[model samples]
Target: MAVKSLTPYPFAPKDTVDKFPAPLLYIGWEDHKLFCSPVCVPMPPTTTFGDLVRGTLPGIYSAHPDFARIDWAQTEWFLSGQPFTPDMDKTLAEHGIGHKSAIRFRTPGLTGLNGSCF
Candidate 1:
């Protein structure tokens, strides 16, 4: 959908990275219907992928019953809808994750609550 303006004027977008304290990172757990949409979190570009998974994600997705059972080694990761393996120790910036990048992960054996996908 495109918005048409009667008067055209150049203006900077408010959601640009410079407007936030940190870059916005969108994360989602695939096949988990509990969260209807992905979560947007402000994160430093320098934050390591390991910390994002271990320190950050737990705080957000731990409430899901299947969270604790996830096998990190087997988890499938996607960036901007493409499959990619991340180096745990590398920073998000190192992986080319810029502001508003979407990161999604799928737990191989865990679909959703009781396999209901919800």
Candidate 2:
């Protein structure tokens, strides 16, 4: 199992480029057969893309080929594992992905992608 945390570095002020906030930490768990225990520090905000990538997701998640289509262009929500049959409903419900379905995706080849895999 892998423990994960998604925490935001303080969102910078719109006018100031260097104003970063301390990240709010969101934690999760990924295993050989399942992913569970999505917890966070300072309470994760509802579905923001940046939050998704930095704190709520595992870095090495890109290695898996099951979530390639899931885009974070509009947001920063990153993922860590591939969901199974029983997990489908819960996963969709939690992420508010109703019409969409999880499919095969590729993990990015960035060095240190899962470097933060907790």
Best by TM-score: 1
Positional deviation of residue 21's Cα in model 1 after best superposition, in angstroms: 1.1
Model 1: what TM-score?
A: 0.90
| Tens digits of per-residue lDDT for model 1, 1-118 | 1468889867767798988999999999999999999999999999999999999999999999999999999999999999999999999999999899999999998999899863
TM-score of each predicted structure versus truth: 0.90, 0.22
In candidate 1, residue 58 scores what lDDT? 95
1-118 per-residue lDDT for model 2 (tens digits): 2235587555534522133242233343322123333443332224453444444454534444433434433222234344422222233336543221222222233212243332
The lDDT for every candidate, in the order shown, is: 0.94, 0.35
What does the lDDT read for residue 59 in candidate 1?
93
